[model samples]
Target: MSNVTTYKVTGMSCGHCEGAVSSELSEIEGVSAVQAAADTGLVTVTFTEEPDDEAVRAAVDEAGYELVGRA
Candidate 1:
């Protein structure tokens, strides 16, 4: 089964930001999908395997945003 998790993110303000965040998170090993909403600062990720929180955080960082933990 897939695991779905939502995380609160900061510093996303537009479509570009959303794309950046989505792009980075989608590259993670177990992530099967990603949806980032700039309006809510929420990122929902679907994972096919156990997720690595640190990797999630790093992806956000790489996209120049902050992962504020589960939403």
Candidate 2:
């Protein structure tokens, strides 16, 4: 079964920001999908397995954003 997790992110202000976050998160293993909303600063990630929190944070960081925590 797939699991979904939502995270609060900072520094996203446009569609480009959303795409950047989604692209980085989508690279993680087991991640089946990612939806990032710059308007709300929320990122929803669907995966087949639980992802490591550190890895998630790193992905956001790589995209030039910060993962504020779960939403």
Candidate 3:
């Protein structure tokens, strides 16, 4: 089965920001997909299992954004 989670993120301003967030999340081991919206500041992640929150936070941080927890 697949589990999809949406996180509230901040500091996204354009397509580049979306790509940055998406790229970081996509590199995670279990993440199957990533969709980051610069307008809404939402990052949707799909995976086979529940991914660690710390890992998610780190990815967002690395992308120069803030992970504001589940949405």
Candidate 4:
């Protein structure tokens, strides 16, 4: 089954930032799609499996952004 998750991210100031976040999230094992918006500070991810929040956080952190929260 697939699930969609929205994560609140901080410190995204431009399109490049959004791209970076999106790229990182896309690399996750079960992630199917990633849409990141710098203006909204949100990253919406679709996954084929339930992904651990920590995994999401780590990917964002490695991309030089902060995962502030999720919905």
| TM-score to true structure, per model | 0.96, 0.98, 0.96, 0.94
Candidate 4 lDDT, tens digit per residue, 1-71?
Answer: 78898999999999999999999889989999999999989899999986799999999999999999895
Full-model lDDT for every candidate: 0.95, 0.97, 0.94, 0.92
The RMSD (Cα, Å) of candidate 1 is 0.7
Highest-lDDT candidate: 2
**Global CA lDDT computed for model 4:** 0.92
The sequence of per-residue lDDT tens digits that candidate 1 reaches over residues 1-71 is 89999999999999999999999999999899999999999999999985789999999999999999999
lDDT of 3 by residue, 1-71 (tens): 88999999999999999999999999888999999999999999999877899999999999899999999
Candidate 4: C-alpha RMSD to true structure equals: 0.9
RMSD of each: 0.7, 0.4, 0.6, 0.9
Candidate 1: lDDT over CA atoms? Answer: 0.95
Q: Candidate 4 at 59: error in angstroms?
A: 0.3
Candidate 3 deviant stretches above 4 angstroms: none
At residue 71, candidate 2 shows an lDDT of: 98
lDDT of 4 at 67: 96
